[model samples]
Target: MQAAILRDKSGSLKIEEIEIDKPDRNEVLIQTVASGLCHSDLHFIDGSWSDFAMYPMLLGHEAAGVVQAVGEDVVGIEVGDHVITCLSIFCGHCDRCLTGHSYLCSHRQEVSDRPIGKPPRLIDGEGNAVNQFTGLGSFAQEMLVHQNGVVKISPDMPLDRAALIGCGVTTGVGAVFRTAEVKPGSTVAVVGCGGVGISAVQGAHLAGARQIIAVDLESQKLEWATQLGATHTVNPNDGDPVMQVLELTGGGVDYSFECIGMKQTAEQAFGMIRQGGSATIIGMIPIGVNIEVPGTDLFLGAKRLQGSMMGSNNFKVDMPHLCELYLGGRLKLDEMVSRTISLDEINEGFEAMINGEVVRAVIDFGT
Candidate 1:
């Protein structure tokens, strides 16, 4: 199979011919259809949350595709089934899974590269082993993953749209529905207008939030946010987002979401919450970075700050329901995709994301 290999830090991805091992019991092979170029991928490229993301690793995690083959023990899915790839693969027997927090499962990935107890799935022409990013590696033409890493969806749902369900959409909507539980008629603010931020706006709209304030530095993104259902828009370049939101909502909002992973934006999200209100940080801030907040404000105002990972999602349940929401027209999945490119154009897609030119640049692999 042809895969885009992330050779090393600050290097162009080299499209290389690789070999995929056969699926073992509990694993499945998927024909890649669409993959979203997420900011988290950029984090790896730019070296934020460092890990043993082995050299020449296959990149990309947010994806959706068709099931090409299934292992003997795989049940509830079969060949030709449409599916969305979920990075949060969980072992059903884990303590987190049993506790109803499978999204936080400790054993969320395959222990061995081979299915069950086999060999690694990926290797070079010389048989050198390579790593898979987030255990999905949808950047390739095909991927073999644990059955738990994918959720079957309706065939009617477009694979391109379903791709966003894997990460950006799930995280943004999950933050509102599962994390903060935004109530009807509530005032809310989202600090970023990227793929995740825009979805956060749509989630707030679907939740019947009366006043949805979208804040960003880009006019184009704010326009997109308005179309999605933001009742108000603020560009922090003009003035302070906190003050603007307060004036628009008459003293801060009931809930605020920080979709841009920055110290200043995180602080703003925390500081703009109304008394007894909650602020959810949806973006991945750099590790070891610190933001100082007044202790008195937290104590006297009863404000709370919490972090949301992948929208605190239980993928198996949440993803299928998200598909239904998209099918029902309540979710704006299609509008979230600004453009699509081929695998060789992957770098350009990330560049667009960093430049804030697109909500999401999807890699479309047409079979």
Candidate 2:
């Protein structure tokens, strides 16, 4: 199989032909149909997340595909089943999983070169083994993943659209529903309008928010937010967005979600929350960056700051439900796809993402 491999720190991904390992007893082999090029992948490429990674790694996490083969113990999913893959694959017995926080499971991955019982998954020219990013590695035409990483979805849902459910959609929608638990008629302000940001807009809309405030610096993204379901839009550069949000909502919103991981935007999101309100940080902020909030204000206002990872998702349950929501027309997964490209065009897609020009540029792995 040929995959987009990142061997060095600061360059575009190079295509490499590599061998994929066969599935072990509890794993599954998937013929990848579609995958999304997400900003999280760029984080690894650009050195934002340099703490925990190995070189010559296969990089991709959000994907959907058809089951080509299944290991002996793999149940619930079988050959020909269509599924969406999530990186937060959990061990069901862990404390986090038992407490209904499977996304935070400590034993989500095994610390070994090869999966238990399966052969080593990848190797380089000198026979050096490489790690799979987030353990899914959907950048290639096929993937060998643990059963917990995949959730079977209806065949009627387009695999290309289903791919978004794995990351951006799950994170955004899950933040609104599972994390912040936005109430009906509550006011919401999402500060970013990328793939994840736009989905947060849609989630807030579907949750019955009376006023959805979409914030970003780009006019085009603001427009996209409006079409997705935002009741109003704000370009931060236009003026003080905090003041504008205050003016619109009479004080501040009940819930504020910071989808852009910048320190300034995180502060802005925190400032826009009303007294006793909650602000959720959905963006991946860099490490060692301090976020300063006034202690006096926090004490007086009773405001809260929270964070969400992959929408705090339970893949087995949440992914299927989200797919149903999309199938029912309540979720706008199709609209989130701005364009689709083949494996060779992956760099071009990444360029578009960096320029803030696309919602999501999916890789049609079938191509």
Candidate 3:
């Protein structure tokens, strides 16, 4: 199969014909139908996530596809089932999984990869191993992943839009519904208007927040945000976004989400929340970068600052419900996808993401 391989931290992905192995025990082989180009994938390509960089890596995780085959141990998921792949692969026996926090499963590595001595799931023509980013390399025409990493969804759901639910939508929406448990009638602010950020805006809207503020530096993105669900849009270029948000909300919002992975934006999210409100950082701020907030406000005002990983999702249940929401005309996955490109145009897609040219550019594998 042809796949996009990030051979180094040179900031570009080269499309090449790679070899994909068949499913192993407890694994499922998927024919990648649609894959979303996420900012997380850009992190490695741009060297922001150097600590986690692995060369010759297959760089996409957000995807939905048709099941082509399954290992003998796989159950519930059969050939021809439609599914979304999630990065939060978990071992059902793990403490975190049993505690209802499976998204933070401590034993993910056990299910994410094959045994060390076994042949790799992906390899180059010369027989060198190629790492699958988060164990689901959906940038390729096919994805070989653990059964635990995929969530079966309704076959009627459009695969292109369903792909977004695999990651960006799940992360953004799950942050509101699961991580923060954002209450209806609450005022919310989301600091970013990209794919994940826009999804967060939609999440806040779906959560029934009375006021939804979308913050970003780009005017175009802020416009996109308002069209999707944001009650108001904030462009940092105009002035201090934090102050603007506070003024708009009369002091601060009930909840704030930092969808941009920057120290400044993360802190701004903290500043935009009410005294007892919570700020959720959903973006993957680069490794080694630290986020600092006022300690006095944290204790005196009872403000809470925390991080949400993959929207703290339990993919099995969450992905299916998300599909239903989309099918029911409540979740706006169609509007979230700005455009769709073929696998060969993957580099241009990432470039658009870097330039903030599009909300989401999906790679349609033509499967």
Model 1: CA > 4 A from native: 110-117
Off by over 4 Å in 2: 111-118
TM-score, predicted candidate 1 vs. hidden true structure:
0.97
Q: What is the TM-score of candidate 2?
A: 0.97
C-alpha TM-scores of all predictions: 0.97, 0.97, 0.99
Question: How far in Å is the alpha carbon of 107 misplaced in model 3?
Answer: 1.1
lDDT of 3 at 275: 97
Give me the displacement of residue 262 in model 1, in angstroms. 1.1
Best by lDDT: 3
- Which pairs of residues clash in candidate 1, taking residues 3 or more apart in a chain or in different chains? none
lDDT of 3 by residue, 176-275 (tens): 9898999999999999889888888999999999999999888989999999999998888889999999999999999999998899999999999999
lDDT of 2 at 75: 85
Taken over the whole model, the C-alpha lDDT of each candidate is 0.89, 0.89, 0.92
Better candidate by TM-score, 1 or 3: 3
Residue 211's lDDT in candidate 3:
99
